[model samples]
Target: MAPPSFVSQEEFHAFHTIDRKLYTLLVINLWRDPVESMQVIALWLWLERVGFKNVVQKILSLPYILTNELADEAVTCLNVINNDQLASLTEGNDTPLMQSLIDRDLSLQFFDKHRLIATQGITRIVNEVCIRALRDIMQHAIERNAAQSLADSQKVISHSLQQPMVQPGLPQVGFGPDADVELPWTQESEVPPDDRTMFVTFSKGYPVHEWEVREFFTRAYGDGIESLHMQEVPPDEQSLFARIVFCSESAIEIILSGMSKAKFTINGKHVWARKFVPKRLKPSLPAAPPVNLPV
Candidate 1:
């Protein structure tokens, strides 16, 4: 059905009033809906820019920059600083990074001319901030520019029917279902038990509930993994999750595969079952070479 339109000024006013009221309610209630909260912050920011109070602008912008959804927007603001806005704001002469670097250089120059080294610290702090900003900008720019290249490179290549079947781990695997074939995991027992049990461990400090994990697995891998048991690590533990058991190899494969899809990792490294080695299996390595050697 077609929606009603607010064509008149009075109708528009009423709509705006309702929208603002709802947004205020959400904020007051501490709503966790990030997208909605971000939109409210954006609305407030716009209003502030159009001659609202400076204090209110500061307040609204703080949450906007700090909130997860709006953090990307904050990064966008940082990009503007790196690109030109902050420079233009600073008497149209210096950007934050540029000002830091130039200020340091000037301080160093002053010290050098006066035969003094006391200004070195001032130069060091300024130089570091400037360098950090420059590095950040470079990273942002490179990632920005690479988006197109990444998309282009992701295009699927046609493979001939006569080609031999390559293994899953190899680069020759096509970007299709064949690339996602489930690895084999079987028990040695001749007759498998009717009830299979899986072990699951979650990292400490994870906000998600145990039942959520089960639901996630159910949706991600239907009938693949069965009967998940969650054991919570200590609150002070570094890892958010760990120590899971699976009744069968199939269940383990399903769980691991789902984990990979969700980008869960150990220490920021992608872990696949085939690539994962137990600590016992990992060979002890020799100690590192001495940092200082005799000349």
Candidate 2:
């Protein structure tokens, strides 16, 4: 379904400073969450823009152009700044990574800039009121924007708003029946009791939760997984592994074949599955661990 367009293409083509900033913030939020549907983003964008009481469009000075080397350093350090709350995490006279690279004041200013933007942008949205208000706004926009006929816009907004958040993980829908109950990722078992179980290995850094493991398989091979157990790799170790017990040997073979159909990834890196073998028989070095979660 097509998302409602509150700001017509004509409105955006003629966006003043404030409208542009709101639009930019909406884009930032979009990047931060790919799962977020477009209609919800448009609603939130309109909500924040109207909720804030600001009229005068202030012309601010442009950002300083950095030397190639300085720019590289700034980008690298700031890219590592995963949390917006890093400013609070720093100690007395202990600068954040941003401060170390760009010096304290600019770091603080940079932090404040994004901080104010996030706070002013998303903070106004209180959950209970947001939905009711958003419906009204989208309805009004649909009515006003003769270009957006009622049939399409209504479906988009309803679906976008009603779509459940994927939660901290996706569903454990597929995989065969081997172990009737799902096993803990850290099951104390030294080996799979049966041939139906297989191990999937990927580079570790991000927490490989049971649901994530289940979701990967479901996406890669369709679900019927009976049980999944994640073996705890050393925290500092590079490679991560999980044991998935399928209902049939065919399920294990389908994944171990590593064909395009079975191939899948965690954070874009390829994951390989094989029949569970004892650590004593298999010899492999630890792979590099993931440094940070994608922002």
Candidate 3:
């Protein structure tokens, strides 16, 4: 019998090859009881259709079936099932037993099975494609939000650096040499007064030495720093703090000018600097000499 017209030449050739093998096997057993041979052929055809339907269902159910092209390919592959060949196998048998085997409605069942499998396969492919598309959209949205957040943070930092620093309850004073400065007292005489010192703090978990501080300031301010001292930390503390004493008090003003917070990037670490402010001493209470008469 001729191959199905819907399939390609290559597909038809493959189908014809398999069909010839099956036909040869049936002819080999044709000399046996005719009724038993026909029954065997009917059973074989039913099993083949059932197995093909099962395999098609499994492949279509996979989540990776992401396009309509794949569904089209699956339908093309299924078209290789040629019912004409199956019908031809029972052509010469005119007995009532052979007619009974053909009339069992196997062709109707196969047609229904093929239509159902095709519908389910197309539905699964469409669903997987939609899911993947939504996943890509959500990923793009997350990346866009992250990029916007980064831009906003940079703008905030730039704006903050442009504004002048304001210390609450302290008068806004000029950095000029003639400006009157109130120097905060300190117990350590070796360290310069608060007006000439810049209190420096390093980012936690970074190792910093005195030489780095001296080198950083001398390079920036042209040898204006008088002394650099790294504070001795307690065993429990991990933070590093330093006292930078410049020869001229103007160095502190120059570094902190026009910025709300003086910050520097040293050796890829963030370091903050500010004019040193000491804790004020409270005034002494008046004597109770007026209460001597009552005693």
Measured by lDDT, the strongest candidate is 3
Query: Which should have the higher TM-score, number 2 or number 3?
Result: 3
lDDT (C-alpha, whole model) for all candidates: 0.33, 0.41, 0.45
| TM-score (all chains, Cα) for each model | 0.21, 0.26, 0.31
Quickly count the clashes in candidate 1. 14
Positional deviation of residue 192's Cα in model 3 after best superposition, in angstroms = 6.7
Question: Per-residue lDDT tens digits of candidate 1, residues 87-203?
Answer: 332122111111121222221122223322222332342343222212232333334335534544444232344346787877864557556444456335432332233323222
lDDT, candidate 1, residue 11?
38
Predict model 1's lDDT versus the native.
Answer: 0.33
How many residue-pair clashes does candidate 3 contain? 0
Worst 10 residues of 1 by lDDT: 274-283
Scored by lDDT, model 3 comes in at 0.45
lDDT of 1 at 17: 40
lDDT of 1 at 130: 23
For every candidate structure, what is the RMSD over all alpha carbons to the true structure, in angstroms?
24.9, 20.8, 37.3
The residue-by-residue lDDT of candidate 3 on 1-295, one tens digit each, is 3345577544543543433232222222111222222233333333334443322233223222111212222222233232323232222211111112223323323533465554444334334322222223233334544554576688889978977788899987675656544345723454346678777765445656678778887788788887787766566654356777888787888988954236677788657676765432212222112111101
